[model samples]
Target: MLLRQLEYLVALARERHFARAAEACHVSQPALSEGLRKLEDELKVLLVRRGRAYEGLTPEGERIVRRAQRLLADRDALREEATALRTGLSGTLRIGSVPTASGAVSLLTDPFCAAHPLASVQLRTDLRAEEVLRRVRDFEIDAGITYTPDSTEGVRTHPLYEERYVLLTGASEEPAAHPNVTRPNATRPNATWAEAAELPLCLLEPGMQGRRTLDEVFTGLGLAPRPRVETDSVASLFAHVRTGRWASVVPYAWLHVFGVPPGMRALPLVGPVHGAPIVLVLADRRPGPVMARALLEVARRTDAATVLERLP
Candidate 1:
């Protein structure tokens, strides 16, 4: 059983088409087919279902595919370990992050890169919490930055910060235009959840975990927010809030990073100060890849709480 044959089998399972799988593996279709046939003969098990078109993998093939994924991950980890031993840590550390955690990821990566000058980082911020966990479990990402308490069964988590919600409003708004606020005092820097819910709002879409947390908080407070604009992108929300007519409730850390976006003001959301713990999650494998281990070490030493507190 050559590793190349296992690679072909895994590719076929992923693509579900022999021709596409062969293309993915960068080999001719006949060569890939012959490799699979040899693998089946050596293992004494029928791996692929024979047909004119590409049939799905057999039951035994499914089992082997799972094993193949682990084997490939371990092989890569071994290579990373060897490289680290020879000359410091040096590899691409892939990270998946939920939208709300995007602002905080640099807290980990910036220091990691500074320490290991040869190491590189790739950060993907479009993932939901579930998708982050899935990618980490599948070895697609080295780690993730996501919210806590959504079932982290096969992963280890390092708590980075607690994401607190805030009410953001346009700083230059007229008194009459802000009819939602009964108080209407520019001096009052804090807004209750009920008060913030009364404005024409732009919020994250309901499918996102950050939005779900907001929904839960609103439901608990007996306030249902009907946002005028909904988006999945935090940058879009920020842009809309900068228009001087729309308001939003978002993580306070965002304001810390982007610095109130010129004409916007972020007020503490009162009456139900809810916070979600954001964490760095990695697969629960002992002696993980060197890059992952080095990144975690940086995360461990980061004073994220102090940095957030000192943010204006």
Candidate 2:
């Protein structure tokens, strides 16, 4: 019914303990309890189920809580935008990046920091596309770098670049030993996908968008790569592949992030290599001055994947 009631309800939903939730809201237990009751009565619904202690929210309450949180977050962001307009660019800009886009963050960060030296840029990595959307809607993150825009209404997007998949392998000890590979062609140590797939493979978890993309390509080529190791973290996969015990499918941009470790080799995913579009996503509403400027600068300077021409 009231903003304070919605705030109390959110705190309770998060903490699930009356005393702790009350403390979080900077109110006494009785005050929080009373506020919730008033809200429930006004809504004419049993928002929270009853029990000896603080129980979970009712199904209806859960739905309301999610919408309420988004509304509250958006309202606060609007206020921040107004204040920031007057103060100039000097505040936090939170960004979430998926594993493939992790390498792309630096492309934006360096230029953004140079432009707004006083503003704070906070970067979070390993966010999935869906998680990025949830955080953006909740105002938890200002923007995200990820695969092509997935049509989340109320979110704006700018294409960062196109990402092409690449195959990486541990440095071959006996390049000559594998007849499948041409004798060290200097370019890639001259390895092909067929040769690369022969090694142990480390791949992203099945559920990840990156993995699915790679799987489609492999399946289309009739290449069945049985991963010896599977993980959700791209960093972990790269680390394993770096040891030469495993091979991996990674974005060409990531070759920069993981670097071509001493014996590591990266081969383009030939046989109809796929190029998926990547984009920078932000809430549709106006962002704070710092975030708005940074986003603009990133869009202006980053050709993102256009630079990948240099990769082998």
Candidate 3:
């Protein structure tokens, strides 16, 4: 049918509410319903199961929605391809990043924008690894910065940097303050994972990717961090550490731009772990969108690790 009809279907799938889907499509509820009805009639299938409210899509509807997503993606790619040929790279580069890599994502985008001045970036740093991969495959985002496994089937990855962990804490006054290793003397000052776990901590919520990484490392060392405060925001973690009441284990990259929060210290977490490889992952579609491939190229050529490692 029409591309407009496909857009309506995709919006419906995403929103799952007739009124909300209509709102997303920027059309009235009646118009959205009429468009879907026309699409179903043209395809000769019962696409949606309707009730008092917006019921779920049929099996056939789900398949068609998947195809619809791809069709819309291809349409957008064609337009972007044409624009790139006329000018240089243009349009917004939509990037989804795992929370742990959020602070370091600018390391990739800053250079990307400088090189292609016409191209803008839309950065979403509030996604998990699985969600980032899912959006990439669905053509929802142009690229993602994440800590990935060795291989993901339909995604192409470029290793951007290795994320090292550090213990962020207040001034060392108390007896159990992980042995006040001064920043000047120790060079790369370090604290054992056990020492970090013993402190009253404020950590990311259990569901967050960064928290899970810390949890895995702690588990490996037979240590479980029972945080006094749990948060979904990295900023909040820093706030708690600044209070001198809570300590946290965080990616060292986070301190590159802002440095450790005032009245706090960042010590490398020592023992039983290598750094996490943060990578740029995107869908592996052949002749993928020009914008996505361009981002991957930026990742390949960029020295994000060097910049992220340079603490303020």
Candidate 4:
């Protein structure tokens, strides 16, 4: 069967609509339908569940779609290999990163681009830890930056750094001269988890690894924190904390990389000291992709101490 037919099949499975899939493949609906029909005839098995509207793929069709995805990924890998042999290593490197590690991703990407000037890099920062691993396994992303837990099997991980948590809040300004005035100590050097939980706080959503770690720590300490606001974006958390009325627990490196916004202050978390080991993950394929290998080289040479020191 033609590779084009396989492309049409995969697109149809993804879109789950005949017209949308045709649009995605840049072909007419009738042409796409004819292509799939021809493919089924060649294979001697019905691929699509035909109806007035678009019915789902048949059981065999589902199996073929999975195989087709792998075939397309292998084709792309072959093309990348050919290009590398002709010139130097050059192609788009897709990286998925968890929200807390998003700011620190530049530490790896910056040096990687400098070493391979012709290579392009795409960084997806809002992925959850599970999503990052899922994308890597599915060939959707070349690598990812996420927390290094104990369950990484069939995946290679490179430890980058340990992320320490901190409390972010607005900077306390001096109160004007008045007979009755009280100012809170917003610039405290450190705060306990219990203390931070008492404030109206904004935090990352529960699905995120960063938020999960914080939740576990709080739970272990016999504290239950009900956040005033929950969001998926770390930038949004910072925005809320900047209002002086809200606070959040975030990574120390986040404050260093993004800087304390004009009226914000970052305080170290006290009491139960905790940190998560951030790592770079790639599928454990024999002779992995050239771009992923190049990124691993950069990670190997990166000095975690130096990276932390360079942070603002």
Better of 1 and 3 by TM-score: 3
Give the candidate number with the greatest TM-score: 3
Clashes of each: 0, 0, 0, 0
Model 2: pairs clashing at backbone N, Cα or C within 3 Å = none
lDDT of 1 by residue, 186-305 (tens): 688688999887888899999999999999999999999789799999888889877777888888888657987776788888897888999889988898877788888998899786
| Order of the predicted models by lDDT, top scorer first | 1, 4, 3, 2
lDDT winner, 3 or 4: 4
Error of 1 at 283 (Å): 0.7
RMSD of each predicted structure: 2.5, 3.8, 2.9, 3.7
Q: Using alpha carbons, what is the TM-score of model 3?
A: 0.92
The numbered model that scores best in lDDT is 1
CA lDDT, every prediction?
A: 0.86, 0.75, 0.83, 0.84
Model 3 misplaced stretches (Cα beyond 4 Å): 149-151, 175-188
Candidate 4 global lDDT: 0.84
Ranking by TM-score: 3, 1, 4, 2
Whose TM-score is higher: candidate 2's or candidate 3's?
Answer: 3
